[model samples]
Structure formats: structure tokens, C-alpha cells
Target: MAQKGLCWKEDEMGELVHTGTSSPDISVIRSLAMKHLPGSYDTMDVAFFAEGSFNKLYCVSSPHLPQDYLIRVALPVDPFFNRESEVATLAYIRKYTSIPVPKVLAFCSSSESELGFEWILMEKIGGVPLSDIWDEMPVEAKESLPTEICGYLKSHQDLQFIKIGSLYFSLVRERVGTRDFGETSAYPSLPIVVLSHLHINS
Candidate 1:
């Protein structure tokens, strides 16, 4: 087997600085809520929820909306992470399948955003993250969670794809687009796998 690999520069990001843990301007987030989710928040109640190495999550509430929201802001400038593709995938699963995913109330990609980074405003998912409460949870609940998640994953097993790439939807084309390639930490070739010229496309 012949091994082929794409050349990538370490400093591929020109001048775009990655501000890990540094949040975007609160005023920009406020303006976005007012503009897109006018029905949700006349005055945004934004609060710092948590921060990860790559993204910051906020808790946003509105008197108008039925539930609170979670606005995730990508802090790191990672070439592999595609927020648009994630939004598209969530929207597709929510629209076409029974899979449970947060509804994307609004989203802005890095280039199209006023905040200078990709962000997603979605319906807040209930319950604490498994990492936080897993240790304290009962064995019955732990067993059930994976069983339920596996069921969800099984639902989409019948859905097939020929080539692997980040998933995105084009409003102009009005369909799911899977052509753009980007780097990722886990998968080198967008969403596909190539090892010693042995292809394992997902």
C-alpha cells in the first residue's frame, strides 16, 4: 500500500489569532439576540455558563421564548473544526430524523459573523453534562443512557454516504452540501480516513 498525505503548514492561519478562553464582545451577542431572536429577548439575559479549551458556552434566557438558550462561541481558531458543518448536521438530523439535537435558533460562521468567530445559538439542552454528574448517577441511569444513545445512533445507520466530508447546507442550492474539505484533530482528511493508501471513508 502506498501512503499519501496532504502538506499542511503549521502557520496556515495567516493573521487570525486564536483567543482561547477569551470571550467575544458581550454587546455583539446582545445585538445578535435582538436582531434574529427579537421574539425571544427584548433584553437579553446573558450569563457566563462555562468555558472549555476551544469554546465558551453561555446561558441566555428570554421572557418570550418557552425555554432558555445556549450560545456556544468557538474561541480557538482550529482549521479542523467547522461550525457551519456542525450547524448543518444538527439542522438536518432535527429536520429529517427522530434524533434529538438542539435546534439551531441562529448561527454565524467565522467569515459571516460580527463577533469575528463562529457561534451558534441553540435551544438549551436539559440536564447536566454526563462528565459532571456521571459519578453520582445510579447504575440504572448509567446503563439506560448508553442504551438510549445507541438507539439514537442506530436510527441513522441506514443512511449512507459515498464520500466523507464536513456536512453543510447551502441555502442557494437548498440541499445538503458535503464537498468542502478541512482539517480536524481526529480525522486528517476532513471527515474521511486515509491510512497507508487504505481508504476508510466515513
Candidate 2:
């Protein structure tokens, strides 16, 4: 699901200047899969999956793996924290909870060689998005989902973070989490809620 965006540039004054979501062609996606995936997956069908404001997602499927894979590529000008922050976010979630999220198989926070983009390849979570099937569910199922959602949210209370930003893992990939913005003075560890996969009307 690649979208063409007009590349914008800024002047030396650093004033508001340009914006566009970077896109990767299919060949590049295939090459990336071949480079990073297991050798057994000699071939893969890389199909465009979806896109968000700052990211384009592609679905990678191979007979070797039990499930399909997803590649999430971040735009060069992503307004949110860097790609590492996203990788760390998913890593932190995986380390801390049993809530089902895509398992981060491989990621490059910094653009490597010709890739020129930060990307993550992971096991895709299977199911129709809650948004797609939400209103069609029976009232009982709809009521029951919130209780499950609240239960999941409650699980985050144990996760304590002092800053109001994304969390990142250290070199050893354990302990000592840091925010995307450089660290600040010690503050009270507050609870955070990541409203992903929820269908609440905002």
C-alpha cells in the first residue's frame, strides 16, 4: 500500500518547510526479506498490507514459517520518536506482558546501506481488526470485550516509568529503560496505557 508523497524541503532558517511519507518499491521489500529472513525462506510473496501517517506495512508470507510476517517501515520524517523507540515499545510490551502483539523478528533502527529507511519485520498477528468487526458482534460479545480490555489495561499498572515518552532497551536488551528524549530528573513513576487494538470511540 505505497502512497506517493511530495518530498518537501526546508530552508536554512529551519522554519516549517516540507512533509511526505517515504515509500519503498516492491523489489526493495523482497530484497530486504531475502537479506534478513532465514535461508529456508528462499522465496516469499510480499504483498502490500496497509499504511498509517508515518509508516507503511507489507505482509510477507512463505511456506517455511507457520504464520505470515509483517514489515513495518517508518517514514523518514516520522513525527513520533525514532524507529528504535517503536522497536523498544514492542520489545518492552513483549518482555512485560502476555498480551498478543507482533513478535519483533528483526529491526534496523538506523538505515542500513541502500535500505535508507528504518524497518521492522515481525510475525503478523492474525485476525480481523476490532474496528472492522466491532459493530457486528452480538451485544454480549461487545460487553465482554471491554472487560477483557480493562483486564489487559490493569496489567500495565505494574510497569513503572518516570518519564512521559517512549521506552527503549539498553545494549544488552535487558533492564534500564530510557526515553526517546534524553533523560530528565527523577520523577514519580506513573502508569501508562497504550490504547492499541481497542475500539473505544474517541
* Each prediction's whole-model lDDT (CA): 0.62, 0.65
Tell me the tens digit of each residue's lDDT in model 2 across 96-191: 766777788788765543566777889888888799998899999998998898877876666654445445443412222222333322322312
TM-score of 2: 0.69
Summing lDDT over every window of 10 consecutive residues in candidate 2, give the lowest-scoring window. Answer: 190-199
lDDT tens digits, residue span 16-132, model 1? 333343447788877776776646455778888888766788888767767888888874343223675577678656755678789888887653468766788888878766799
* lDDT, model 1: 0.62
| Highest TM-score against the true fold, candidate | 2
The lDDT leader among the candidates is 2
**Could you tell me every candidate's TM-score relative to the true structure?**
0.64, 0.69
- lDDT score, candidate 1, position 102: 96
Error of 1 at 88 (Å): 1.0
Q: How accurate is candidate 2 locally (lDDT)?
A: 0.65
